[model samples]
Target: MSEPAMSEVVANLNLVRERIAEAAVRSGRAPDAVRLVLVTKTVEPSRILEAVRAGQADLGENKVQEGGRKADALAGEPVRWSMIGHLQSNKVKDVLRFADEVQSLDRRSLATALDKRLQSVGRGLDVLVQVNTSGEASKFGLTPEDVPAFLKDLAAFETLRPKGFMTLATFTPDETEVRRCFRLLRDIRDRARQDAPQGDTLTDLSMGMSGDYQWAIEEGATVVRVGQAVFGPRPLPDSHYWPGAAGTA
Candidate 1:
């Protein structure tokens, strides 16, 4: 498939932003309160540039290596980079090099690694603790009971700012379950704000993805990660980028 024209991408982004605004308003929250994070995993840099030009000030990449490459390519662009997927402890330093915020600080080791890396850089990082609210065996995150203590330990790291929480609801086409998990994250965010260490903000819930983002917004997702909904279903990895996976274009 040919890359979308810059104008077309901008139109699509505006439509998605409007949808987020509508969802936020329906939930009795201000539209500005909800931030749309364009999930750039597997997406070409051209689409990423389109999103940046369209006023998507925040972009999320799922892998550290991929994000690092993209960040280098898009250096000097007006965008905030977020690590929105599972981050390995050993990769923390590389990930923090371009990550303005990390939305997947789940394990204690990862947080500690990030803390050390950020301290070395002499910069503070905004982080959202990933919670496995869906109870999926494949997911990595702090359980509900582990959150408070995790927050306490994280607060000891001067360079790590515990801004909020993030979760990936089970990938079923079930809005009810999605909403339940989103609501749970919101409740946890509230509790974190109330119980967090002396100076933490505990705001910014980075929940939901393309499929269930409406439910996430209704349940108070300050940031939503969207990919196909904006760029269309991704081109297959091993295929040439054109119609019918060939040179028909």
Candidate 2:
């Protein structure tokens, strides 16, 4: 696939931003309240830089090595990097080098790895606990039932700040199924707040993708990972971007 034109990236960004605004307004929330994190997996560094120069503040990359390369290429640019795919303990070092946040923090072991790495550098990281709202075996996240206890356990990792929850709604055309998955994440967040060390900190919901961001906004998503709508469809197979074939934004 051709790299997205600079003009195309800018134009698509405008359209996506407008859609986000309309979605937020329909949900009775200010447009700025919802944050857009452009998922840039498989996009080359130059084109990714194009989007960054076009005013995209947050960018999500699925792989640590790829993110690190982009981070190196775009060093000094004003962009926040996020690891939005399944994280491994071994990759924590590379991930910490670039990611401002880890949106797929699902396991205690991974949390421990991240905390240890951050402590070495004397920096703290913002993270969202990933929840398998769709109940799919292929997805990587804490089960909804396990989330409350998990949030409580996060207090042990001082370098890790719990920002909220992230989830990938079921990849289907049915809006009901998609919205249900999103609402479940919100509901779980609501219930887990009482068990959290700081309830106010769990203020963001990282749900939604290119296909169903509006539904996610209506269901209370403060963070949306968008890709195809902004960068155009990725040319590779699902496994190419998301190992194990997890759905992309």
Best prediction by lDDT: 2
lDDT score for candidate 2 against the true structure: 0.89
- Listed in order, each prediction's TM-score against the native is 0.89, 0.95
Give a tens-digit lDDT track for model 2, residues 1-249.
Answer: 899555788889889999999999999999888999998888888888777888898999998998999899889999999999888899999999899999999999999999998999999999999999999888788999898788878989999999899999888999999999999999988877776785878888999999899999999999999998988988986577776535658
Candidate 2 Cα deviation (angstroms), residue 209 = 0.5
Report how far off residue 246 is in candidate 1 (Å): 29
Per-residue alpha-carbon lDDT of model 1 for 1-249, expressed as tens digits? 999555767777888888989999998999878988897877778878988977788898778898999999999999999887777899988887898998888877887788777777788988889897887666677887899888888877888878889888866777788788788888888888888793348888888777778788888888888876787766654122211111100
Clashing residue pairs, backbone N/CA/C < 3 A, model 2: none
**Alpha carbon lDDT at 57, candidate 1:** 85
**Total clashing pairs in model 1:** 1
